[model samples]
Target: MNDYAIEVRGLTKRYGQRTAVEELSFVVPRGSIVGLLGPNGAGKSTTLRAIVGLLRPSSGDSLIDGVPFSALDNPASHVGVHMDGFGFEAGISARRHLEICRLAAGAPRSRVDEVLEEVGLAADARRRVKTFSTGMAQRLGLATALVGSPRTLVLDEPANGLDPDGIRWLRRFLRAFAERGGTVLLSSHQLAELEQVVDEVVVIKQRALFAGRLGDLVTSDADSLEGKYFDLVGGASA
Candidate 1:
């Protein structure tokens, strides 16, 4: 198998005259957790969207295991995605929603219950989505992603709605996934959480800025990831 689970090659995205991402390139190593770090409007979302084929790039390409997301035969089986504000019908039960996704992915029906338990949503499985808290909704999104048992996960701001305990749980779960040979590319506003979980970090300021092992970014002189992040992106914003 390839050492890289995902590779972006000179990826660029534009909106009319405005460029969102420019010549971005990076790689998520196989069986590792990589953090995509950037400030607001730094094209993090745009970059991720392009990888999942939600938007076409104006130039360059993104590849998963050497193939574009659109070209994959059974994409859900290989790449599971959880973008910000993933939606569901307000009235649908969480269980029903997962069942629908399982059918669409042609995954086994047993996957629904398995994912529910895995995400700690089995107890609330029958509850309407509208009644779920932000944390619950996030779990549901994760469950949806896991239903296909994909080898790679591309999640955007997955820690947004999670509380302290939930964040801890997620850290443990993702680490365990990587230990099991799953690749993870996670985008997050929480630098502290990223530092705790990611094996590598990719920083961007509307373009590729830094890509390296987590420890490399944090020099002996640097105090923390927040300080490093500011040093990396602070100049760009100013």
Candidate 2:
């Protein structure tokens, strides 16, 4: 088995004249939660999409457990992914949506209910996707990711619409997952909350500015994630 759950090596992507990312490299260890931090337009989303095979890199490559994402025998069984801007059919029930995903992933039908319960969506299982609030929808997305029983997860803004309790629940859930040998990579603007959960941090702005254990960024004063982030990336937004 590989020592790292994810490895992005000199990954680069370009769109005509625009460089989305350039020479970005990082590794996510097994059974650890790493926060991918960057300002807006930092190419965080692009890097993630390229790593998961949603977008091909113009140069370099990414691997999940030592194999390219496209080469995985059963991708969902190895890595779960949730990106924003994805929406379900307005009339589709959450349960039905999960069932469809489960089948497509070649997962057992029983996993649908298990993931629903795991994500706190069991009570809303029959609710139509359009009827769900942002928080509920986020939960549904997580359920979709979990149904495959993956060993790793890659999530973009998983806490966007969650309430305080929901955020706390997610923190606990991730900790428990990692304790059980599951790896997680999450990208979020919520620095304070991120500081509480992540074991490592990867900061970028088009390219990798910093990547190391969280403790490395925290100085003698115990700088906060937000403070250290701004300090490293500077006051600029992009």
Candidate 3:
């Protein structure tokens, strides 16, 4: 099998005269948890959208498992994506929502219950999505991504709504997923949580800045992911 789960080659996105990203390139190796870090307006979302085939890159390619996402068959089984919006219907039950996703992905009905349990949402499976807390909603999004049993996950702001305990749970869940040989490419503003869980970090601001193992990049007792990131980006807040 190919070693890289995702490969972005010279990715560029533009909005009329404004350039969102220019000549960005990165890779997410198989069986690793990689973090995509950047400040607001750094084109992180744009890059991710391109990777999942939601947008066509202006001047490059975004590949999944060695092929462009648009070229894959049964893509849901290979690359699961949870972008900014959860895309849940407010009135529908969580269980029903997942059932729909499963059906669309050609996944078995059994996955609905299996993924709900995996994401700790089985107890609230029948509740309406409008009634779910922000944290619960985040878990539901993750469940939606996992319902198809994909090998790679591309999540955006996955930790946004979680509380302290929920953050801990997410950390453990991501670690377990990597341990099981799944590749993860996630973008988040939560640097501390990211540092605890990611094996590799890709820091960017409108272009490729730093892309490598977190350990290799921060190789001193006094150094930290946050410090290194600030040094690279000049104290800009995410």
Candidate 4:
């Protein structure tokens, strides 16, 4: 198997006359959590969308475990992606939503309860999704992603609307996931939250700019990863 869980070579995306991502290239090593950072309109989301086959790339290509993403019969088994909301039916119970996703992903029914417990949602399994707070919903989304036990995870702004305790759980969960030999690629506007979890980071400013280890990116002069991020991305905040 390839050492890289994901590889993008000279990737580009265009919408009409505007270019979203231009000639982007990066590699996400297996069993590592990589943070994708950039300001608003920096094409972070577009790059992820292309990788997960949501939006076709305008140029170049991406692969998951050396297999082209498009060639996979069921890409979700290899890559679990959570973008935006959890997409659960409000009236449905949390457990029911998990069952539906389990069936759709062809995942084993036995994994459903395991994932729910992993995400700390076991106590609320019978609660309707409509009553879930934003943090609860986010945890539910994470549980769904874990149901298939994918080799790679792609999450966009997962920390949004989460409280401090929830963020702590998320960081711990992601760290544990990576330590177990799974690759995680996450994008978030909250650099502080990411600093606690990611092993490496890929920063794009209008396009690809910096890609390296988290420690190297956040040197003593930089003091913090977010500070380095601002400097690298032209001091622009999303």
What are the Cα lDDT values of the candidates? 0.92, 0.92, 0.91, 0.87
Q: Pick the candidate with the highest lDDT.
A: 2
lDDT of 3 by residue, 56-139 (tens): 988989899999999999999998888785578999999999999999999998999999999999999999999999899999
Please identify model 4 stretches exceeding 4 Å from their true place: 235-238
Model 2, 68-162: lDDT tens per residue? 99999999999999888667888999999999999989999899989998998888899999999999998998988888899999999999999
- Residue 182, candidate 1: Cα error in Å is 0.2
Q: Could you report the Cα RMSD, in angstroms, for every candidate shown?
A: 1.2, 1.3, 1.7, 1.9
What does candidate 4's lDDT look like per residue over 20-51, in tens digits?
88889999999999999988889998888889
For candidate 3, the lDDT comes to: 0.91
After the best TM-score superposition of candidate 1, give how far the Cα of residue 45 lies from its true spot, in angstroms: 0.5
| Per-prediction TM-score to the true structure, in the order listed | 0.97, 0.97, 0.97, 0.94
lDDT of 2 at 199: 97
Between which residue pairs do clashes occur in model 4?
none
- The lDDT, on a scale of 0 to 1, for candidate 4 is 0.87
Candidate 3 wrong stretches, greater than 4 Å: 235-238
